[model samples]
Target: MMVKQERAARTRQALIRAAAEVFTEEGFALASLATISRRAGVSRGALHFHFDNKKVLADAVERQAADVVARMTGEAEAAGDALDALVAATHALMSRLASDIVVRAGFELCGGPTRNTGAALRWQWQVWVEGTLDRAEREGLLAEGVSSARVAPAIVAATVGFEVLGARDPEWLSEERVARFWELMLPRLVAVAR
Candidate 1:
């Protein structure tokens, strides 16, 4: 029983990984389950057993990616100071985004018919941004009355914009430029002292 369960788990992970790669390279409309099964080297039956459809496979990928993002956010929170934490988190996330084809593919899949998958990813980022803002406000880093609700969306927007830009011309956006863009933009949203 244990061996069977282990194999099943491995098969599931393999499908998720393979689907992410295919989706990232081909986008949702073009990616197919047969291709994903072939990539994973698993029987089509095994793929169906693990996920009901491509939508389910995409959700699994998004969940796995969100787990990674959540962990990085937690690390940033533990690092101290809101601005520094946010910077650290952004750098960590961008680094992962640049290297992880699975994550890049998950983002590409976000525009599909799976509203739940897209919402899950958006909510994950929003929660992280809101948490960072709340911490900054509590630490006296933000100007008084600065609402996390208001700033969280902007922060998320900037991050997404950077990701899109990086995706288009990775050579042009280098890590240094991405970091500098965030640093320059963050202050504009900081509360002005009277």
Candidate 2:
């Protein structure tokens, strides 16, 4: 029974990884379950046992990406400086998008036209960033003139833009690109001690 459960777990992970690859390359609409099963090296019965449909497989990918994001953001939240934590989290996200197909597919699935996943991973990320900025404002980490309301949207938009642009040119999601973005924004966003 233990061996069976272990095999099942491995099969499930394989499906999610395979789905991530297909979704990242072909996108939600064009990605097919047969292709995913083939990539996973699992039979159709095994695929169906793990995921009922393509949307379910995509949802599993999103869940995995969310887990990755949550772990990174949770670490950032543990930092002493909220503003610095936010910056670090954003940098981590850019690096993840560059390296992880699961993370890339999660964002892509959130924005796709086909099915509504109910909760968009991108929206969750935007909310987390906005909340972090608001915390920074409350902690007096933001510049005197900098407002969380104004800054949150811009940062979210820029990050999403990076994700979109990275789809075409991998350079857009590079850590150096993210660092350049923060280099310009940090001075404008962080408060200077009087």
Candidate 3:
């Protein structure tokens, strides 16, 4: 029983990993369950046993991705400056997007039109950023004229743009590119006192 349970867990993980790669490369609409199963090196029966359909598999991928993002950004909260934490979180996330297939797929899947999942990952990210920026404002990390409401969309748009552009030229996901973005934006974003 233990061995069977362990095998089942491994198979599930394999399916998720395979799905992430397929979804990342082909998008949710184009990704095929057969391809994902093949990539996972598991039988179609095993894939079905684990995930009833492509949507379920994609959901699993999205859930895993959310966890990844949560962990990635969770560290940023430890910083003394909320704005700095947001910047660090952005850097960490961009770096993850560059190197982690799962993270890229999760961000991609969040925007997929086919899925009706409530509050897509992108929205969740935007909300989180908005909250952090609000906190920064309270902490006086923001410029005199800068408002979290104003900055939230810009940050979200730029990050999403990086994810989209990274699809074509991976260099867009690099830390250097992300750093350059912050370098230009930060001076305008930080308070005069900061």
Q: Evaluated with lDDT, which candidate comes out highest? A: 2
| Clash pairs detected, candidate 1 | 24-105
Better of 1 and 2 by TM-score: 2
Model 3 lDDT per residue over 46-155, tens place: 99999999999998988998988888678888865798789999888888888888878887887777777764777778878999999998888888889999998999
Rank list by TM-score: 2, 3, 1
Worst 10 residues of 2 by lDDT: 112-121
lDDT, candidate 3, at 15: 96
Candidate 2 residue pairs that clash: none
- Model 2, range 44-154, lDDT digits (tens) per residue? 999999889987888889989998999989888887578878888988888888899898888888888786875478888998999999999998889998999999999
Question: lDDT value for candidate 2?
Answer: 0.89
Candidate 1 yields a Cα-based lDDT of: 0.77
Best by TM-score: 2
* Candidate 1 per-residue C-alpha lDDT over 1-194 given as tens digits, one digit per residue, 9 for 90 to 100: 99999999999989989998888777777889999999999989999999999888888898788788788888987897787788888888788778877666666566456444555665677677888888777766775556777777888887777666666666423679767877786666566652
Per-candidate TM-scores read: 0.84, 0.95, 0.93
Measured over all alpha carbons after superposition, the RMSD of each candidate to the real structure, in angstroms, is 3.0, 1.3, 1.5
